[model samples]
Target chain A: MKIGYLGPKGTFTEEAAIKLKKFEKCKLLSFDSIVEVLDAVDKNKIDKGVVPIENSIEGSVGITLDLLAFEYNLCIYREIIIPINHCLITNKGVKLSDIEVICSHPHSLAQCRKFIEKLGLKIRSFQSTAAAAKFIKGKLNYAAIAPKRAAKLYNLHVIQENIQDYKNNFTRFIVVAKRDHEFTGDDKTSIVFSLEDKPGRLYEVLKEFAKRNINLTKIESRPLKLGLGRYIFFLDFEGHRKENKIVDVLDAVSKKTHFMKILGSYPISKIYESNSLKK
Target chain B: MKIGYLGPKGTFTEEAAIKLKKFEKCKLLSFDSIVEVLDAVDKNKIDKGVVPIENSIEGSVGITLDLLAFEYNLCIYREIIIPINHCLITNKGVKLSDIEVICSHPHSLAQCRKFIEKLGLKIRSFQSTAAAAKFIKGKLNYAAIAPKRAAKLYNLHVIQENIQDYKNNFTRFIVVAKRDHEFTGDDKTSIVFSLEDKPGRLYEVLKEFAKRNINLTKIESRPLKLGLGRYIFFLDFEGHRKENKIVDVLDAVSKKTHFMKILGSYPISKIYESNSLKK
Candidate 1:
């Protein structure tokens, strides 16, 4: 099997892809951007592609949600949740006190804002955390905020571990393919819909799930770009698409929406057991 | 009056601030970051702070929402919606064919991506659009994606206007102060709350507004940072807290959520009338 991921290697996405590889041995391919990986998956160039869906701290990855909603017809085959343990990495023998500059992706920098502020250092943003890790190779005065694995891969020493301001940081990734997975008892169904401009339509539509005792896992609203107050909602609920209750709920909800699209139904992630090893 | 804005000057936030200044004269002080501006308002260092709350294309600004939900005690006093018109700015006498590089904030770069890609120039990122405009001064080969106002402020020339990928882009800014505005008859209220982890708690809370025929303008769910599937909801509805129906809705809704905070109530923006001249 062939699987693609967003990478130049040594990214959290790659780590998630590697974990997915154990379920079934597959050749892992790295793509430059998230769109490229999803596009490759959609065109059958790769069997499946792994990309981040949401972060515990950052909330949902808007581009991923938007693409899955409007641009792609792909289905989520599996879900993976990984801890985002940012480490302070520097060149060998470099001390934390000697570092005058910090570098990382903007999100990583934002996540570690409190730590950086206390350190009183200048910040530089790289396109990716892995790139920042690689860039600090011979720069003794620069420390990077990246995953610990990147430190080992890039031959850098980790000066401090788990430097993110919040200890509970985690990113949820999804494997997308042309078609979704079959019934998995413990699964989640993702869907997006736009309610007619009538007040309370959202409340009425959500009642279908509530009345059926279907628990919602996530809910997000994105502007349709038509204007403010105009929105399309994306939701994830605890059920497989093949389940009878899910079918009934979708039918009821669809009737109340101007339009609806089922993005996917996939098993809930259980990667914390293995991710603990890295932490 | 003293007001704070996220700026180095010549930014969209400053543009929003200038529009606000028309209603009542105020001295606009520039801050390095969103947190600083909001923090200043919380400490009463400034009478008010103007910060971007949401973009029509980018959705909600997570930092702004997170701060209001968790850290700060300030209340939103007004709402300002302005059209985001990106321009291709360069030094005077520079031709389109002479440009070899493009520079701007990441968000601005992403918004004008298609235009830049068509031009096939190397991209550079700056801390802000205003900074990028300043950096390209006297460099004929470099073009910056910024607001036209910046071009005038920095004595640059606009080679092209409205270069964003989408034409419907708009950003909503909020004026935050120690106290919220008195009801203007036509106003909107914002609130954030966490539901009590029940399967249907959200539906029940939303029903309070639905039953009263109250219209919701925006609904967003952010991760509580406690764990996956845990969320704190931020909502804006079309009524002031002073309204009888709004008071009843808040009372009913508060009884359902584990915790709740009323962010503010203020007049909705109608800045399109004034912003059209800039567009």
Candidate 2:
């Protein structure tokens, strides 16, 4: 069961893909875009594909959500939450003061803004954290804020480890499989829906979840692109669609919502606790 | 007065600052980073600064929101909403088929992924939309997807216009000034706060706004970095705190919330409904 994911290698996605030891001896194929990863899964180019759905620092990956909305048949099989640790890496013997320009993925750089400001270095953005390490390897007098694995992969030296401005950083990744596997009974369903442009419409939808006592973990809206007043909501609730209550909630919600799609209800990851360690 | 914004002279911020000309004699200052714009505002380096707060296409500009929360004490004095119109551009005499590699700001590139894939070119990322336009000026083999203004500013010809996959694309920007101004009466307040991590904590805080019928425009959570489970919620609501009802709502929220800071409240920009066209 070979798997494809977003990568040029050494990205957090690659890390998450490798952790899936169930498919041992399976080849790992990396693609440049999340859409490509999804297409690969849809076409059976890869048995599974992994993409970051949310980050503790960045919130939901809008493209991932957009992809979910656009691609109708793909099912989410499993979810993985990976702890993100960023490091400041540079060419050997490069001192902080000697550096005038720092390059990294924008999110990584943002995570260490205070440290960069304290050092007074200019920042240049790269496409990915691993790509930043690659940029540093080809240049001198620059540092990259990236994962330590990136430093190792790109043959750079770590100037500082765990340089993320905040501790307990993590990114949530969802595994896209061709079809939904048997549920483990304890699973969460993720859905996206759009409400008509009217007051109390959204409240009424949420009222269903609340009245049923179905705990909602998240609710986010994106522009439906129709106009200023229109929006689509993405909701995550702690129950499997296979459950009777969830089925009723979806059935009622389907009638009220202008557009609704159940993205998937996969077995919750084994790691349920939010393990953010305080420094 | 000169208002510097994050831009290459023709990005959305540039467009918004130009639209603000009726309210003030505005000179546009383009900076590479929003933090730089914030720093300039803090040092009185510029009379005002406009930067993107959120985008319908890409979601929240997390770095901008983060800077508002932690690094700067600037107040939002005005708001500007710009409709996003992406165009594919290249040097004169260049055709789409002539391009082998494409470059743009990541979000821009991502927005135009469908078109780029249909054309089947390698897409590279640059720091900003304008920078990509500038880079393509001397490079014959690369084209860029950027805002319409960027193509005009950099003297590049548009290969294709309005190429975004979604028709309902818009970005909201805020004009930041050093001192807080009197509320416009018809205004909005933005604040960032953290709550003790637990299930339903977010729902409880949002309940405050929902109960008051305050109509929150946006609510997003960023890791607080205090620990793994903690989060800071950034909220945009319909009314200013200077109003008695809003003040009471805020007071009630502050008591129940662990940490809170009111970033600013000023007149929500009427830019969305204006007749002003991009010059």
Candidate whose lDDT is highest: 1
Chain B structural similarity (TM-score) per candidate: 0.94, 0.93
Every model: Cα RMSD to truth: 2.1, 3.8
Query: Candidate 2 has which clashing residue pairs, if any?
Result: A225-B168, A276-B228
List, for all models, the DockQ compared with the true complex: 0.69, 0.38
Residue-level lDDT of model 1, residues A57-92, one tens digit each, is 878877788788878899989999988888999999
Model 1's DockQ? 0.69
For model 1 the local lDDT of residue B175 reads 95
How many clashes in each candidate? 0, 2
List runs of model 2 lying over 4 Å from the truth.
Answer: A22-25, A91-100, A270-279, B178-185, B196-214, B226-231, B271-279
What is residue A195's positional error in candidate 2, in angstroms?
Answer: 2.0
lDDT at residue A127 of model 2 (Cα atoms): 67
Tell me, by TM-score, which candidate is best. 1
Error of 1 at B258 (Å): 0.6
